[model samples]
Target: MVTIQGIAFIPQNISKGGEKLYILNKQDVPIVDGLINLNSDSSQANLSEAQQQLDLLWNKLDLIEMNDELKAISPAMAQGKIDKRLIIVHRYIRLNYGEPLTLQLLADLINCNPVYLSNTYTKLFKITPMKYLQVTRMKKASELLKETNMSIKDITTHLGYVNNSQFSTIFKRYFSCTPVEYRRNQHLQMRSIGIF
Candidate 1:
């Protein structure tokens, strides 16, 4: 999912997360649809036009009145002209982040060399595949800790960790708190803001 500006945009099925995001204005729907349709075209000329469409999207977005309830949608269009294989690899990572994933395995998804995949992925996304997986895992762990009542062991298992200590160690390294402490802190912050 791509969150442009402050709006949540789901790139479900095609790439990234599959869950839907917030409600968008009726007028803005066409802009989102246009961009999707524009970028999905692979012809060189249309792809160039798609870049213009993306630019137009930014200009149109500046006029949107954002609110707590706004939502966005997309077909997982990679910005400008991008290698389609990267899109496939990206979507796979998001959908299967819970599984034991590796750079070689991700490269296998496209029958490409691991080194080539690593370099291209890093060049395009500005992060290595393994790093993205770690980030994605941490992000999922954070969501589970704050939003679900799953136990630490259960969460660790769901995240493909072999044991709680390993998960806790990584969690603390990324978040500066253990899973339990993080959950408690989130609850405290929510209560302070009247969310509880």
Candidate 2:
């Protein structure tokens, strides 16, 4: 699953800890419809679904380029880029998502005012830093679920959640499926593609 921003790429794998595992950018860059796996293992009927999705996305992006007058310019160009503040926030989210981090705590760590951090993050990411951290945690948890056999309780404790309930709630909310469901899907996918 992809997030609101295209930069993050969450794979089908779910962590035993109930977080979403992100794909490496080198193997999968954040292009349009990049979530469409080129080698999806999910139990979907077609193994080539990912490739087809990629072709469709590429065509759509191509059409937009062809129709727009900006063809002379680089369609790959990024405009309205984020500032350094957002970069710091993203880094913080990556580094501390599994920890019991608070906004105030992050502000203090970064030597910025909490309000300023909140405002900047909201303006740029369209979500608070906490939300980003939650997403990050979920992503990592999903990865663990797919790649490891650690118990669910162990995953929850590792992520620093108060208990399994909190972890389940967040995991369910984001994935629209329980951690187990996500894991099952990943297992089926892996088996279908002979990854297991």
Candidate 3:
């Protein structure tokens, strides 16, 4: 699973060396949620059901990304396919987004020059590494706001922001609403759907 610009994609490699990335929207989130729930059953029937759900997810996804997007996502075949370091950095971001991260820190992880890392990352990902990190944190913030009882003040520190005001500013910019407002709306929606 990969998320960019508030969208999640389930990327599957083709039979050969290439890959096809299926773009999933907010509406397809249930497919992922169901997949997680179905994963715990450990039965043949559940496995079949899980496979059907995956098929349904694939059916619901949009087509492969455009050439420009694919280019940003992957380097040319001549450049040794994809950079291993970038993959490491991306995976690191997904795992540790709650912590404070800087370009120098990310570059130090792979023993590369900071400027080179930033430039190459943007060329490959179409966004600066820090921007990627912010988006990642915002995504996690939304999940926490909706699913956890942690107060907004605590969530601010948990997400590595200096204070509530800063977190609120960024959250509002990202979601067009304060964190509390987003959480309330999410709860209302969930209640309406009989999930709460």
Candidate that would win on lDDT: 3
RMSD of 2: 11.4
Task: Please provide, for model 3 over 67-141, each residue's C-alpha lDDT reduced to its tens digit, 9 standing for 90 to 100.
Answer: 335556654635785677986887787678878888899999999999988888887787789998898789789
In terms of lDDT, the poorest run of 10 residues in model 1 is: 65-74
Q: On residues 59-147, what C-alpha lDDT tens digit does candidate 2 reach at each position?
A: 54334423331332223234544445555666766776767888898888778899988987776555688887887688678878886
lDDT of 1 by residue, 65-157 (tens): 222112221222334445679868876886788898889999999999999999988876667888878877997899788867999999998
**If both were scored by lDDT, which would come out higher, candidate 1 or candidate 3?**
3
Compare the candidates by TM-score and give the number of the best one.
Answer: 3
Model 1 alpha-carbon drift over 4 Å, by segment = 1-81
Q: Which stretches of candidate 2 lie over 4 Å from their true place?
A: 1-86
Task: Quote the RMSD, in angstroms, for model 1.
Answer: 15.3
TM-score of 3: 0.63
RMSD to truth, every model: 15.3, 11.4, 9.4
Please give the lDDT score at residue 44 for candidate 2: 55
